[model samples]
Target: MSLYGGMNTAQGSNSCLCDLRSDTMTAPDGAMRAAMAAAVVGDDVYGEDPTVTVLESRLATLLDKEAAVFMPTGTQSNLASLMAHCGRGDEIIVGDPYHIYCDEAAGASVLGGISMNAIATQANGAVSPADVTAAIKVDDPHYARSRLLCLENTVGGQVIPLDDMRAAARVAWDAGLFVHLDGARFFNAITALGCEAIELANYADSISICMSKGLGAPVGSVLVGSSALIMQARRNRKILGGSMRQAGVLAAAALHALDHNLPDLERDHANACALATALTEMGAGDIQLGSNMLFFTPRDKNPDALRIHMADAGIRIGGQSPAIRMVLHRDVTDDGLDATITAFQSYFTKE
Candidate 1:
């Protein structure tokens, strides 16, 4: 009765549908659906959704934060946290390749009227602490106030170690700037680091944890921080059109995910490592496995061909151009991985 097995059988293709596109593709399992159906409901806009309240409380406790607010997506959670912590004309230091900088539609600037100062990230997805120190703005009427330092772990599937995060946080704190973490995959990093989520959360004034990523919830992310910050974030969420009424149904699934799915992430990580090893052996570009994300660049610059070939084989992957990235999730299995390996080998062998 696991929801993990299904294949696209309409075509003549024998390939099992192994969705490695993103963690967003995962469907709610039976337990998740059941939890949703049976969930106690209340108006979350009025701060009364019992399920959501439980989820927030649980996440806050897990992260050792004073409070938590549930939001529609990781982007919203991160933006709301940033909006809460920073003011207009404020600048936030972030890595050049971070989701906020490269993705996210520049909400920090457009909506919050904040400026982003990009710092170079090392190959390990960590910025130099010295760079953070140097980026802090001098108090001047002409210069934008550097109010916050934002960090992303598992950046583009590259995990930054705890020491790097601590050093950066220390630099930001010494500069009197608030620190925020776009921890969409904080759980994955925690599992990978063999540390409690708080170990990372402690360094940042706010941390955004995604329920829908490795946790396999159908939707939502949690932003955890001090109670005052969460109260402010709730207002920002409302402003951003994220306030939901009677959202406990979704919160129930998230609760189910936290309880049942977190431990299974190790399997996903293992599968990623296995896939990386296989792809590297098959002469694919360096396969870097970080938690559940496997970023593999091809030896040649033919990402389009690889994408098309995989699509034909019914194995969905993401990314194009210079490099192709693959993510392993609970929906993918050891058997499905074999099929993916076969598909890749078949595609490359003929080329």
Candidate 2:
């Protein structure tokens, strides 16, 4: 429908117009671009960007936190929050599959000098409270001080249950460890859980909510927490070279998305379900259909073969080990989904 063409051809057969590689692959629409163009700019380093301030404030209110700071990326936000919460040589308990552990380049260990202690994560992305308890270091001078507990919601798009979050929080509170949430796909989690964003935020000392993902902002994330935590994160952000001179333009788009786009996230989830179901019918592979993400192990495990096949057809998907990850986002339309489904069906039905 609105195929604002940026088609990059790949060497295969036919291709669908939909780009489901990752939400990060989404391009800001014309309205978002227009908002960015007309945005009031200021030096965020001096706290002078009116638009950035408003966006931060609004995010804080939505996340039910005392304050918020806009970050250039969710990775930076997560790293800054971790740095703000823990001291050097401190350990943080986390799920083995957490973005901080797997996706992010061990920033806590290399940059912050904080150690990560991984606990076995359940299929739903929740770490056992017993595992968290066992992971906490005792008051031994020989051990790294366990100072934080990290959790990821919608871990790879599978929503961690609320009770699991509460249990993890209780375990962390009992051990005097601050809890941090890597809520990169938090909107998906909130929509899936049928709860307010704060319901998840309340269990953690801080949250890193991504604007560039499901929210449809071109780029940016927001870290929300107590005023002190955010102030600390601000300094860490500067240290990490994340302080922007004219970030309000980006903030404006995030603001637009919060008002106009947040309500439509459920549609993306629906699209994901439809696509997942259709793929299952086509015998694509074993699919983990959760939230707005579908992780499927292709019947053909050759990554290069499958990637080249899909690319030739024009549908871009994220290749993650044995699983081919297809994410539904704000820009991918219903028509696009239908096209994607048909393309996959045709591919599988062929030799």
Candidate 3:
């Protein structure tokens, strides 16, 4: 059972439902709310918010970085990191399907005049070192200088192996490029790998960690790097209007999540695997299981009809076929998993 219980139930007419759309749907539990309410808050813009300061310091230590800056969203955190690393007409090497290239609204190019050299990513979510090496540009006026390489852990929920990360980072560093990790699902990857977070962080020059996703906090992401890099990122954050006042309320919730919810991410992963197994057994869809996420492609039923059937059963999903992603979080209970499996079973049976 979840400490937060069923969040979909609270949304009205969806009582005791399962929301598989995304882990971002999680709401803070009562314990997290209590922490928020009791948080010691000061103006964060002035860098006096004690809770925010603690959260940043703790994350910095956990990731073995010299400093960390808190931002309102993961998008802004990545943008700040990008802007801090690259200058006008500079480029970053990134995976084509990764969040920094596809989901972040092109803030680097739109706001900082940075270009992205998107390389093809492997099915395992790693960009090949050969591709990365080939992407680095020479110092020519006609070409954009490749200043940095951006990588994502758990890209599309698949954890990138530590060996692969090191290889890619080595390729970047040997070419005189800095490395940044979009680690929005850093803990999820850590949980699945059964490794310390610092192990992953050691491979990158900086990392952006989201507290709101599988960690179950309502908001906030942290950017961790060397003090000099963080100082630059802080300025970039301010330019992007990510500076917050009295942000400790949100930080406290993140603190609570780090303390209470992180350990349970493995449970969400187990539930995802269980759901995938059940879906596979029913011949409902082709299933791809990753840490706390499952992608299903219906075999016998129409995708739209399957979606409508699940929606009617109070089970919500996201994306369009050939694959629909279902995310598990702290808010999704074992019963919710059962309901989801049954919904799929029923949908396929009636076809």
Using lDDT as the measure, the top candidate is: 3
Q: Please give, for residues 287-314, the per-residue lDDT of candidate 2 as tens digits.
A: 9988999888888776556666665666
| Cα lDDT of model 1 by residue, 9-127, tens digit | 35322244787867767888888999999999999988889999999999999888899998989999999999999999999999999998888899999999999999999889998
Q: Alpha-carbon error at 122 in model 1, in Å?
A: 1.3
Of models 2 and 3, which has the larger lDDT?
A: 3
lDDT of model 1 at residue 134? 90
Give residue 224's error in model 3 in angstroms. 0.2
In TM-score terms, which candidate is top? 3
lDDT string for model 3 (122-229, tens) is 889899999999999999999999999999999878988999999999999999999999999999999998899999999999999999998889999999999999
TM-score of 1: 0.94
Instruction: Give all candidates' CA lDDT scores.
Output: 0.86, 0.86, 0.89
Ranking by lDDT: 3, 2, 1
TM-score result, candidate 3: 0.95
Model 2 lDDT-worst window of ten: 1-10
